[model samples]
Target: MKLIIAGATGFVAQELIRQSLRHPDIKSVVALARRPVAAPPGAGADGSKLKSVVVKDYDDYPEEVRRELAGADACIWTVAITPSKSKRLPFEEVTRVCQTSTLAALEALHEAGVGRPFRFLYMSGTAAERDQSKTPSWMPEYSLLRGETENRVLAFAAAHSTPSASAPPDFSACVAKAGLITHSYASSLFALGLRLAMGVPSVRLEEVAAAMLQQVTTAHGFEKEPLQNEDLVRIGRRALGEGRA
Candidate 1:
């Protein structure tokens, strides 16, 4: 099966790309990003299956980019400005990167056509609240924006769900609401500090990547519409132990 990893340069997406290249089921891996992406080290012989597709802008899908994405089996979207980074730019820019680009890609990919039951896993944060009426206690505006994007993605998929299966192609979308994504390089103290400040649970980077890969590839379908941090931890641990992801 072919898998597309958007925002390939991200720390989490890098891990997913590495794992996907090595996985037996994922025959081809497409790395889509603003800049060129090289197959990560340690992917072994299977690394040859990886291909990088550069896009000048995520919101614009020219013929070249669309052709590369044609007939894709699944896509994991990781593009979004983090809360910390959002503060550096105007909120408009943040929403465009986090929300607009996502919908644009979704529409473009669907228009380009895809394999049956096209699976899309959107990477969202635990703090995001879909209910715009109820403002979150933390980063209310940003959280709401992310949440709104999630709802849009779900709506897009539902429009092409099984009932309308051939709205040309079938569609399914799942959201991964992660918390602090800790990695091996970070000091435990720093990770703990962020968890406390953010007031959200944490999951290892490898675990999140592995869990998401399993969801789109090995699992029957999404384990849940929105896989939470704990769900990611559990599935990732199991996949790692089984040595499949």
Candidate 2:
């Protein structure tokens, strides 16, 4: 499979890229980043790895960047400023960058002439609840905005799958809402306790990457709602041949 990974520098995205290289079925990867993404110096020992595309702006990618998108089978979109980072910027800028950038990337895919069933995996957050109308007061804007984007992506997928006479070629999208990522051993310990006590899944980064790849390669159809962390863990483990926990 040929794949495109947006936000290639992200923690989870990098793991996906690394694992994809090891999968015999994956033929090529286009790692798109705001800056150049370099292959590990000795990465070829396993298999052919990623082709990096560096652009100054995700929304205004250059023609050369567009050219690299040809013949792509799947796109894993992992772009988003974290809530902490969003707090530093004006909320308007955060929304525009997060929402508009997604549209631009989808437009680029359409313009590149990608075929039907071209999978697009959106890395969203578990906090984007289904009830956008009843958003919490503390961070209502972020929740609603992200939730709204999820709806838009689902709509886009529906429209693309059944293009009109003049509509551009497009693809399907599935949103994966990953839970709180614990980067440290302590965090992992906490996550394990949560999993055992509440049965709420908190994904390991590798697990999330695995699930994203699974959805990309053979998503039966677009899912209108987000795939929560527990869903990710279950789906990912199945893909990895570990079965369910």
Clashes found in each candidate (C-alpha, N, C closer than 3 A) = 0, 0
The total of clashing pairs for model 1 equals: 0
Could you say which candidate leads in lDDT? 1
lDDT of candidate 1 over 1-245, digit per residue (tens)? 98999999998999999889878899899999999999887767587888899999899999888998998999999999999999899999999999999999999998898788789999999999999899799989999999999999999998876675324336899999998888866645577887788666888888999999999985477888799999999999998888976
TM-score of 2: 0.85
Residue 139 of model 2, lDDT score: 68
How well does candidate 1 match the true structure, expressed as C-alpha RMSD? 2.4
What is the lDDT for 27 in model 2? 81
Please give, for residues 1-245, the per-residue lDDT of candidate 2 as tens digits: 78998998888777777777776667888999988786543344344457998878788867788889978888999999888889899988898778889888888887887756588888888776546668655467887788788888777877777665764334667799998776579989998887788664588776788888877765364433468788888777787784211
Cα deviation at 107, candidate 1, in Å, is 0.4
Number of colliding residue pairs in model 2 = 0
Instruction: State each model's CA lDDT, in order.
Output: 0.89, 0.77
